[model samples]
Target: MPHHLIRKLEHFTKLSCDDRQVLGAVASKRRTFAEHSDIIEEGNDPSHVNLILEGWACRYKQLDDGRRQIISFFVPGDLCDTHIYILREMDHSIAALTPVKVAEISRASLDRLMDEHSRVTKALWWDSLVGVAIQREWTVNLGQRTAIERLGHLFCELFLRLRGVGLTEGDSCALPLTQMELADALGLSNVHINRTLQELRRAGLIVLKGGCLTIPDLAALQKASLFNPNYLHLDREGRNLDANEPASD
Candidate 1:
């Protein structure tokens, strides 16, 4: 049913049965990628939009020195590249963090869906805007926050995002990244990442084990990290519009 995509879209605005049906069609074609494999390379001309259905992927860029920086994480229901057809070539690469399943929607299919489904189009726009906001938040996390704060903020954000998609159980969610991967994402050394993780555990703020992350006290973690949810734009938008009608009205 592509409920993950529906749940995510409805977070922005309600979706009708038809909206849900079309979204299901959007996810009809599925592709799988092995863990640590690049879903799309940095310089390749993107042909289709990839929507995550299961597992995780990350957008990252590699420097000439071989250092990699993870720009963003894509969970289920997240689009890897929605309007990337406009670009001549990809600016960054996306890699699977686990055995990942994705829906590959071609440009023609996407355009037809948007042309026919106004609500879906608007929801997509909301999703795109939130992506930009998240990038900005990551920038602040890297440039301004301390190591502990950076890690804490990331956890809080991931927990809420997973919970929103009904992928989280209680205060916990699947976090399959290795310590080295976390180091790459957070711009820290492996040793530094390990130390910061220990500190978080000692503080009784988080419990990360067995490829899963659990927050015992979300509010306390948010405080320590100076985390804010406003950037996610998770609040339901366009409430005045009818779910079954076109969003343009």
Candidate 2:
């Protein structure tokens, strides 16, 4: 692993000195990705399990006639394949939501690391559980919420997720997505998306101008969308420190 990459993972993974030394002994490569690049494709061979060192991405499945259902967006520090470990081929595809950079850790190396250190493996597994929670939230939104509310819920989720990685501002974030991307993720028509967005704007909830989003009434939007961030398990990493009280550098 590169010295800087090893250092960063150690900060996040809550690794012991011994384990960090072991991982640092191995070579880890960084890979850059362009926006809209397909990092993992449905029905393609699964050769590696990737970790996101930077950028945003979405895991999605497309229906016939080109309709798509976005599973979840991957961000920095997220594992790209926590749920696809035993795959003969990828059952779902992952695409960059923005220009991305990742660390490509081969399966063999990951296996050895897991066998040697369960905490590292468990940390990756925790990521997939969060992904599942995001999917559940989506399922609930699709099944229960109105289109406007669904969009609000998704926006809240994305905003919080981005903020977790320190990629968001106080009440807004850079939105690189088009209306089409929003429609696919929320299962609404692009035209409907525009109308709903306009409604939110008129109601003093949010504003999207020039692809930038500003949420003026976050509390109202969260209430309207019925969004709750408890399922994300974002505090899990901190718990390890509380339990162990190990000196961190």
Candidate 3:
């Protein structure tokens, strides 16, 4: 089976056969969750870290009044959080947005892997930093960008990310998010999300239909969103690690 984690890590640094084998073993324990189910709830101690193998999930914080703010979306190849075992309890919850499959890696296994493979450990660290960077960018998106701009930026980010993991087909990718979900993620009301989608459609910048998002012109969409791919750090930050390993076939 194809491993999205390996594909994602290879974006930053080449992985050796040993590294791949270890990762495959780590990911062997798989579980499935139905849509809208809580994978990990707030205030609970988690013994294992989740590696998303399929479908989408989100980190969200809910208020006393039942309002929810989505913090981040996890696609295939995303780790829910690294070193999360250090926390006494989760501050927020992670839930499945769609039918999800995950590999539950125990803390002990991860510790052994880190101890044995320095390069793999560093690559995981890089992945964690990229998650932080995306969080920062989302803060800016929510606090500064207009509703349309925010949507455009999000679309651009998703396109690039799915592309990185080989999920995108040319200019299109599966969105699988409802307008209500988009509203929650972007901090907009359902009506506002619908109107923004209408605007984007009218401008011919995007074509979203049947759970698929297609950017007719990526450059124009990026310009509209004022998106800078710099925050993503997709440029092989862990490339130096490649020097230590033999060339991969």
Candidate RMSDs in Å, in order, are: 2.2, 3.7, 2.3
lDDT of each: 0.90, 0.74, 0.91
TM-score of each: 0.95, 0.83, 0.95
lDDT of 2 at 175: 76
Best by lDDT: 3
Q: What is the clash count of model 2?
A: 3
**Candidate 3 lDDT tens digits, 1-249:** 328888888767888888989999888899999999999999999889999999999999999999999999999999999799889999999999999999999999999999998778888998899999999999999999999899999999999999888899989999999999899999999999999999999999999999999998999999999999987777784445555658443
What tens-digit string does per-residue lDDT give for candidate 2 at 1-249?
333333334334676666666554433677888999998789998877677777678889988898788777776756776545678988889999888887776777777877887765665566667678877888898788999899999888777776666667889887778888888888889999999988988888888887678888888999988888787665655435643666342
lDDT by residue (tens digit), candidate 1, 1-249? 777878888888878777888888877889999999999999999989999999999999999999999999999989986899878999999999999999998889899999999889998999899899998999999999999999999999999989989999988899998888889999999999999999999999999999999999899999999998989887776444565665342
Arrange candidates, best TM-score first.
3, 1, 2
Worst 10 residues of 2 by lDDT: 2-11
List where candidate 2 sits over 4 angstroms from the true fold.
Answer: 1-27, 237-244, 247-249
What's the distance in Å from true for residue 33, model 3? 0.2
10 residues in a row with least lDDT, candidate 1: 240-249
